[model samples]
Target chain A: CTSPCAAPFERRRPGFLTLGCRGVSTGARGDPHSEGKARRAGRIAVCGKACLAKEVFGETLNESRDPDRPPERYTSRYYLRFAFLEQAWDRLAEAGFHMVACHSGCAAALLGEPSDDRTWNSYIEYVFFRS
Target chain B: CTSPCAAPFERRRPGFLTLGCRGVSTGARGDPHSEGKARRAGRIAVCGKACLAKEVFGETLNESRDPDRPPERYTSRYYLRFAFLEQAWDRLAEAGFHMVACHSGCAAALLGEPSDDRTWNSYIEYVFFRS
Candidate 1:
């Protein structure tokens, strides 16, 4: 998975390269299997704008299962790994790549949420140039 | 200011264009002149890692001025205008551009803060392609 994933980036140099991935919560705590079971059992229901997650991933929130919990609280997908932007920048720097640009949190705006500083930091993109 | 600022973007087409700006706090409230005066008078002091703001902008926190307040609470620069990412996307789309990438919040990591979801959303960059 690592080599194939990195091949394209290594092959291109002295050229603009853009890379990005979905941001996952570093403090996410929950059991995906249990969440899936609960969702399948209809114990989970989509809440508020979090329905965007369901629309994109076919996943439902556990809000109905626990009414007292905040609506924003939800289980993250277990398979997705969180990416550390700082580490990525370090590695890229080591590879002689300089950052041309970086952006994050626009996904919230794309999903029709209010365009504000409070936008979910759920996606990140970086543009790098190597020479 | 508007025409000169937009000239470069309009001049380039069918090519990669990356644009970015420092992100400002949307809900920031306070007077910059007063904050500067307080800092110069030593009524304010740098608190924790927020000293990065000082290193970059010569600004200091009001922690000493109001020890009872949270250290994270501070006045923002009054001259900086907040940009709405959604509005930018809309305008870009209307101008016959399509987003190639977007990223935000990496400034926290660059300043040696813990790279996590809680990174400050203080910068945004977007790469667009027109064709």
Candidate 2:
């Protein structure tokens, strides 16, 4: 993941708002604790969309940023930050993982009219396989 | 999971709308394939709330149910069914899993006024540990 992707966690934002890709260690076929034997899988599952965050948060998202606070720890009650799909693709590509499958859609209840582009469609899930 | 909880998958709803609890098998500490060595973990992560689904889908949610379709397979374009938190608690308790921790809150952007209760808070995440 890139700097932007790690920014949320590095800053220790509230658990709910720190929407970022997480790596899950799936033990390899051999010894469980052997070094380099575990296959780490990165799942960007059901992450909030940047576009939707911007739409919903607007100016409050920017106002919450504080330069005085240490990067290692910070908290906010207002901002909701999430990465764009393009960023996820870029970071995974940088890490040499190829997209195995990707699915993007929103709930029927959140869908807007055919003529109306603004919708509440909020999340995207992606599965990437390491090459 | 109860009949209502299994109804969605039993009818083979569209992949996105099948917002039901799923059990993931985490290989047990010993043998990976041994009969009783695998522990199944049920995660009801980031599931849509029934209240929000009702608020959004309204009449369409009920209209999507069909009496003639076989229980094994069916699909719908209109329904966005999700279980209430109470239902999840009941199911997990019945399955012998105790609540390890649960945190429920909406995104700051989705939060309504202190006086306004009809907010767009859409989802809830729950974590349960098997005994």
Candidate 3:
């Protein structure tokens, strides 16, 4: 069990790194396990995006019951990790898009200032994260 | 004769790339050539920095008279180009430095902006170029 499992979160656990779980229900409070079980009982079949669905059930017993194995590359663990990394890289790249001109004129200043300043300091920051 | 020599000036000539000559004598006016001669006859040897001095007359007939080549790297053409490139790179890098935290927090934001904005528009611009 991950250390997070012991520290019962009060305010509905805010999202953090989740790829480690392959979207499998950890049976933790606020986890999707109970909802999934209830939905199944009601026969209200719920389908999710393929990637998300894989994320949700890829680690459970049902995953092993299937005779065919998902490609190792498409395994929930690998896919989730890749998704996480790709999201981070995309965000970083988006933040970078804010200053196309500045990087061209002044080299030293751009390279020397702190990193967060460029993304969070100006209208550009708002543009990158919010808009 | 330089291409610029053919272009007649109405208002005072704006500065351009000028480190092609040594600080000896180019015989070109508004170029410190006549200034150097007039000052010499008038007993006012307007002194300049060694580096700047090397820049002015480094290409004229006088340069041939001197045996020293002033390290091949320090020649006007070389130094001026180097200085220009260094200054350009410094400015670009400085523009880059403005987003230090951004670069760290979001790798893409800082790298994508143009070269002038980081140094020209933001308060950081005043901080870098003006201050």
Candidate 4:
């Protein structure tokens, strides 16, 4: 990885990003830590189209600044405070991520679609234990 | 496409469901609507574990019930209200999803790992536009 892309945790810019994470708790191959660790932490720069940004960060925007008129305010901007996953995943993988359990969109991003078809690309532990 | 599974935007459960969405907006083929319309919307049931659920729905739980004691209270629960994406993706695909943008976790799920390499299993539009 390069400068900013490499050190995703330290990389920050004045732009939009849509983020999320993934973790592999079982059957992972790379690092031992990743085998049982939560495997994500970081960010990604997005072009931030208005509607897209709004859709992505609408609720968070409301919670942070204006709970009353969040959607309207979010609509006013061209960016969003996305969930911190993309960057996290990148950084973890660079460091070494084992078998990541892709959560939410992260899971979908891995599995192609959310079905029981083995044809899917993503594979997460069907059973997770409480640690 | 199954009964309740096929009829998404309707399947509702009684507990935790972390939610999120993703859209392709490019290179998709199977369904015209999916190619353009946002590529995610639905819920998946997690076998809620306290620490996991807390990490997942901490913020949302706080925002909804107690901002001050959100994390603390979340720790009390064995599950969290997850984003509604897994169910949505499963429903959409059985219904027919084309090239999807697997936002957030959905993206990670599709992409194997979040690095710029061809070895990845997931593929999404790197460049999405204002629609």
Quote the chain B TM-score of every prediction: 0.34, 0.30, 0.15, 0.20
CAPRI-style docking class of model 4 based on DockQ: incorrect
Candidate 1, true inter-chain contacts retained: 0.11
Who wins the DockQ comparison? 4
User: For residues A43-108, could you state the per-residue lDDT of candidate 2 as single tens digits?
Assistant: 323223342233323443442444243323433322323322333333433433344443322232
**lDDT of each residue in B13-119, candidate 2, tens digit only:** 11111222222222333455544322212322222223223332344354344434333232222232443545645554554444433322111111222332211
For residues A72-116, write the lDDT of model 1, one tens digit per residue.
334332111212233333344454556666555433222232221
- For model 4, how does the per-residue alpha-carbon lDDT over A27-108 read when each residue is reduced to its tens digit? 1222211212122232222222232333333443323332344321332222224433322222222322211132233342
Docking class of 3: incorrect
**TM-scores of the models, in the order given:** 0.25, 0.22, 0.12, 0.21
User: What value does the lDDT take at residue A34 in candidate 4?
Assistant: 20
- Clashes per model (N, Cα, C within 3 A): 4, 0, 63, 36
lDDT of each: 0.33, 0.31, 0.22, 0.27
Candidate 2 chain A: 10-residue stretch with minimal lDDT? A32-41
Task: Give residue A52's lDDT in candidate 2 (0 to 100).
Answer: 28
Off by over 4 Å in 4: A1-35, A43-48, A59-131, B1-131
Candidate 1 regions with alpha-carbon error over 4 angstroms: A1-13, A21-82, A109-122, B1-131
lDDT of 3 by residue, B7-102 (tens): 323221111111111111112323433433211000111111222223332442133323364421122112222323234324423322222221
